[model samples]
Target chain A: MSQVKTLALVTGGSRGFGVAICEQLAKKVENIDFSLYARSQQGLESTEKLIKQIKPSANVNLFVADFGDIASLQSVWSQSLKKVNFSEYQRVWLFNNHGSLGPITNVSEYVFNSFLIFIDMDQDHLSNFKEIESEITLNVTSVFVTSSLFLKEIKSVSTPIETSVINTSSLAAIQPFDTWGIYCVGKAAREMLLSVITAECKDTPNIKTLNWSPGAMGTDMNKEILVKTKDEGSKQFWEDMIKNNKLVDPNFSAGKMIDLLISNTYTSAAHIDVADA
Target chain B: MSQVKTLALVTGGSRGFGVAICEQLAKKVENIDFSLYARSQQGLESTEKLIKQIKPSANVNLFVADFGDIASLQSVWSQSLKKVNFSEYQRVWLFNNHGSLGPITNVSEYVFNSFLIFIDMDQDHLSNFKEIESEITLNVTSVFVTSSLFLKEIKSVSTPIETSVINTSSLAAIQPFDTWGIYCVGKAAREMLLSVITAECKDTPNIKTLNWSPGAMGTDMNKEILVKTKDEGSKQFWEDMIKNNKLVDPNFSAGKMIDLLISNTYTSAAHIDVADA
Candidate 1:
């Protein structure tokens, strides 16, 4: 009997939510292979150590890459996949959980009036629209490009029943946030993009796409956004106005991420809002 | 007699559709002054020539600057408006109609990806997304940031009526096109960005946003994508169809753009599809 091929690749896996995803998938899933991508080798090692602590024999590989770099992203599928035998995997799941929050200043302060700042922004953001552009490219564009690039390798594999994608979007995907303009726009686009991908792969039964809006979590992003606030300010502010009561523990969020992938409950082409679910 | 401010300020007035819009407005309205923006000094002179040809005493002034360069864009606005005397202008209309088109190829083929190219793509051509990402940037990031930048400026103006923004989008804004994925995705984001802008500015009635999709036209971008012969091609044979009366002239399309703006029939927060109109 052919060994089942079950592989999972998570971007931005070095720290925070991504690292948690690595640990959860390894501990919860059976006979799984994993590939996690991040910008630094040191960070990848930390995630690898955590995964190994959970599952001694977990087939977890680390890929060092900047998700924003086109060449690096292309390599994630081409050079990185060559190291693993995809044919042995019965299912392939990719989790794009990486992002960068751009500058907090009002964009108009510099963009339209400063030639220098505008050029610097375009160069620094990697051709992405300011806050929203970078967020979308990192969160959404990478998933689309990486999946399309490796369709050939994926199709060649016979054992995998189907390939599944779980995109980590935000509640902001549907509702626009005040300072989180780009973040909201990018997530919204991701929802539609998942719809587009599902439509493209409609004929292929083995492929599934999901737009998962992970409600607020105790992640580094939130910690940073809500810094300098006491329990009263933090708790009351989010609970009262921000409506951040749905904040889940990182491990719990990771478990939920894995559950969505493992469960056959995901109808193809569905926009799964974690809050709604 | 107080000189009335023209209802719209069109960027890239030297050639293409910008000049056409000025001509249309000049003929359609009375007592409306025009403020045109372009990068080239020669082009600005030519625009003045054309305006004078239509109406010898027409109130038209050229604001020279490169929009792609944000600082220049600012200088143009500040200097151009200085000459206008804001008290005379009641309503401000901004048409962001300038962009550059890049090559269409696989993402791997180009040294630098052109995700900004969506601002310049013709709607009919479908694109390999990875390639398009490499070539396009403006749509993913520039369009929204720039739009917001303009909105920020117009909001401060004491113009009693309202400021309306007409964003130039493509049919690809609604659906995907070949060799135009990056562009399509960018434009789609542009539409939503405007939606966000409108929603964000709901309290401020003076600011209005519209996303208009102009159908395929005989513009330079379209001409390049047209198939020399539509007959037997395995894939990418839309040009042949154009030769067989499948394509439409862009001038007629511009008429639709003008009509949308002038008719005021379309509301501020609407995403209007010209082909459907």
Candidate 2:
């Protein structure tokens, strides 16, 4: 019977589903130290307060990070790691929960009208590639870099520790959306990255991975999707969900995720939606 | 038909499947003008020779450019388009055929021992992110940029031209391969990009797109896969493939792909493999 101390590293903990995930983890994981990273200090503090109120004794450290800025991202991640003693914990959880959909716009200079192949693009088309590159760096590159770093750094610890890597995936990972083109690509790519990790670590039962898709949620993200989406049917579908109040709560979705990790019932490296779970 | 002159632009036209595809297009398409881009002038020239030997009157222009260098890519694409009068042709084909398997190694610092999660990364680990980013830029970013630019620039011609954006995809696009981590992600992402395009132009049958997977071809890529792959079972499978001479010929595969294009029966934006086609 070894003593168990868990290290829950959560990105995007400042707000939305990230905050909910932090709060859920706070209530569930006993004797846990949270390394919460996000871009906003104020938001991180608020999440910290919520976490502390739930588990007063939980030790939480916040790191302000901009995933789009790789230089700052590297500095932030390294700085966060300086204080951590990996051997002090028997369990490590890496939650790749941070992502962005960029601008909910058309694929490029094309404004996307069916049957109309050519339309005059605006001056904004000049900077389209820049936006596309930045969005990709944030959504796709950061996930790969962070997960690789986490596995590398954490595994360096001499002692054997159970590890779980949870990817905050979406139905978008498997399905394509019209205006959400880049978002869908990023999500789909991230899903495959997890699948590769799953295949590579198949024999290692302790190193469990799951792509957890939190269903359409009542979050700022959903609000953005509803507002900026270009596809009428897609927009109407989401608007209906909002009007019907049918969206999943962030906390409820986070609970399912944490429960899946705790219950250890999910097939490692498989995508399990909150609805299914 | 008043006039239908086809312009076929193939990347990776230096050798292997690119050459085969160019050859097939030269043989099949009447009054075809070929604009071929690749890193090797010799190889593109070879492909051009093959095309000219088949269709003696085929007008071929070769651009030697590196997809890895975005500056050079822009220059190359723009240069290739400089001499072209858009209205001269009724069909424009942009073949996103160039991609890299990168180093057929593990994802990152992790060597992937299944049970052993961490191993000391070499000094090469310092450059790992650089490689990852570059591979991504070449495979995923370039595909998006090129396709966007092609659709945008070519559509401005005002005259109705039948355009086909053919993405050189693979089974890797749908299945995750152990050592081919970035390749798999890039392919998968490209597949979705076409899907988004498909959805965007559902009513525009003139704007055809296909994710043409050429199958397990006997090309330089296959040789590299055989040599560098880290997984024993995967390597064994490929080795058996080589031993049994089960690899698809590049020309045969290319013929299948072009035939699918000529037959025009594949669902828009669907992945159509050579064997399946």
Candidate 3:
């Protein structure tokens, strides 16, 4: 591998794990250059300030974009690359850590009512159907757009060494939740996409595409899902499930991810589940 | 398992494979009824006409609504269910086959050769980083929103047997092509969704879900992709491979699907790779 400093791009870097990913990349990778993508301009600026505070000489830049919109990703990614002098960097580490969780109440009510009625199912309704469609778009389609754009870049770059594409998938990618059909489906597709990348870019040894399930983290997305459902009884239940069995702190997860980036042991362009990692 | 006629709701049943699914159901199962969904009034009429022509006494009702639109699905599904007299039907089979294939192009061309390059990677055009975002709403977001709503119905339904959701995913769902990122990502997420269903509903056997890859049929979508990509330089490769390997026709493939559905032998709510099937 070349000895050029690694360049890192962290999406959803405005808060939570994204911030952690940015910080860790700056500290771990020597001569690191960073581009942080997030929706909020203020968040982006704040993140940049923090990066600069940590390493005044770090070539840190902020790009505001919404993963929900394909255009934002297209613009943000393209603009970010425009500033890079790739010759200076030996390896590139792309960390896609942004995602949203929502539409949580559609199932708990069904489960509760079914428990009461002793009926296995609820009467059919259409409103919930539409919500699922929206969620799939926000969760899945956006990932495709972003990944597709990024992968294209990885393939085209004239770099001599290796480049890694790390997608932020979820354990939920393999497992489903009660009302999280939309989210689950999106993540599942992402896993398949990693497989596809594995097959398509089999010859592209210089590029390692992977969907990394950072496991569950105590992020806003986790809290958001809880708030959407408004379930007091199951709050502790979910928290316990995460704390006891599922959730991993963002910093710990980010550190592990940085290790994976440096380890370079994953030879196939397939998704690496964190539980297994 | 119930002797009562099976009730199937075929979204986008006006024509194409959706109509084919309806016809196949009528011929294969006795006393089967279909609630057909389509946005086009003429398409619905055509489906009804075809159903009447095929089986003079087949009980087929038309529900007019855009499956791509969330609110439309809600209104159409609810109103249509009310009219159907739910007591009459025993088990529900939701064949979600309605969808569209969006633009095919690399991220650069789609976004005007912008965002195609990342910072430090393409410093030549660093000053002109601002580029227009892709118009992804109509082609991608619409399907996601509607599917999300449909999933809600799947979660909420109270039928004796869990509703069967067979999403019409594509080979693209597993792989990314130059111009089909939007469609691929949307379907990819849905694939994960079924996994989610499998994990969450392990105890609940009523709902049978499959992220089906209906092998590359000579459908309109395939034709469009082939035409757009000039056969993607792999048509001959696939055709030659299939001919040499004696690949089965789509009709035969559909037969295997019907067999799987009726026999219920393949019970795991796992992703049944159509290629494998």
Best by lDDT: 2
lDDT per residue (tens digit) for residues B1-277 in model 1: 1344455677767776667667776665555667787778798788778777876766777777665444345445666655655556666677766654443422222222245346535332334445444333434554554565566566556655556777777766666433343455566666666666666666676667777666655565666554321223412455555667755555566677677666667776576766777
Query: lDDT by residue for model 1 over A1-277, one digit each (tens)?
Result: 1255568888889877888888888888877778888888999998889888877877878888766666557766567877877777778887867776543323333243445555555323222234344455676567656665555466556654568766787776666544455666667666655555555565576877777766677677776656423235344665553463556767777777678777767886566665566
Model 2 C-alpha lDDT per residue in residues A14-86, reported as the tens digit of each score: 8789999998988887788899999999999999999999989888999999988776686578668767888
Chain A TM-score compared with the true chain A, each model in order: 0.81, 0.91, 0.82
Tell me how far the alpha carbon of residue B40 in candidate 2 is from the true structure, in angstroms, after superposition: 3.4
- Say which docking band candidate 3 falls in: acceptable
Kindly report which residue pairs in candidate 2 clash with one another.
Answer: none
**Interface RMSD of predicted model 2:** 2.5
Candidates, DockQ? 0.21, 0.46, 0.28
Model 3, TM vs. native: 0.79
Assess the local accuracy of residue A85 in candidate 2 as a C-alpha lDDT between 0 and 100. 86
lDDT, residue A127, candidate 2: 40
